[model samples]
Target: MFYAHNFSYKTASKSLPGAPDLDEEDSLEDAVVVFFHVEAGDEDNRKGCIQKFVKNTKWLCGKFATKSVLLHSFNHLSGSKSSPEFARGVLDEAVERLERAGYTVKTTPFGYFNEFSIHVAGDSLAKVFKEF
Candidate 1:
């Protein structure tokens, strides 16, 4: 599952103990925020799945013309979720790919609940959702 939003502002309000420390004290602006879920079935085509996800993310970023991206693991979208370890690895790989392509990437704390404050763009293209 994939859901993305072009945001003018976004910040993590609160996170669990294990969540990574935020590098930026202020809210991030001009970015695409992606909420994705990995299902257990995806394990059959892990590499290809990740590549498609990354490509779609880049496509959305291009539509918004932003080099910044935020990835959040959201399992609430479906019942058949992948193992947390594997899901996290996927996020990590996506981050590496995006960074290699010159996009600044940020991830919310994995395996934890976070409260985020976001101001999404008014343009219709700012919101995108897909399932694969």
Candidate 2:
């Protein structure tokens, strides 16, 4: 499903920022893909980036194990005011969480960009989830 305005940062799809990629029903070696698509009219689109990311990370920590990897993308169609600061803040937070979970990550797309993706080792994800 897709939305255009004022979408929720957290969703049931598990497409949060730096969301671990888990096969769910399959092996952990595969990746889990989370797609966040917001319409142009959506409010708080800027903040949504970070919010979604955080939500995804929390979900990963709580519900998933290490064998899963997360691939996240916060996207909006043409229009609206998504800024670079939003992306930076979201990325910074995501990196922090990923690091804490023993996963290394990166970000891209300068100045009011689009989305981001996260990759973690199966061993690392498994290791992190081992605690839970």
Best by lDDT: 1
For residues 81-103, what per-residue lDDT tens digits would candidate 2 score against the true structure? Answer: 33434544555665576667665
Q: Which regions in candidate 2 have their CA more than 4 angstroms from the true location?
A: 1-29, 36-52, 67-78, 104-132
What C-alpha root-mean-square deviation, in Å, does candidate 1 show against the real structure? 3.8
Tens digit per residue, CA lDDT, model 1, 26-94 = 346778888899999988888987998899899988987878888888875688988777888889999
Q: Point out where model 1 deviates above 4 Å.
A: 1-26
Worst 10 residues of 1 by lDDT: 1-10
**Which RMSD does model 2 reach against the true structure?**
13.4
Backbone clash count, each prediction separately:
0, 13
Q: What is the clash tally of candidate 2?
A: 13
Clashing pairs in 1: none
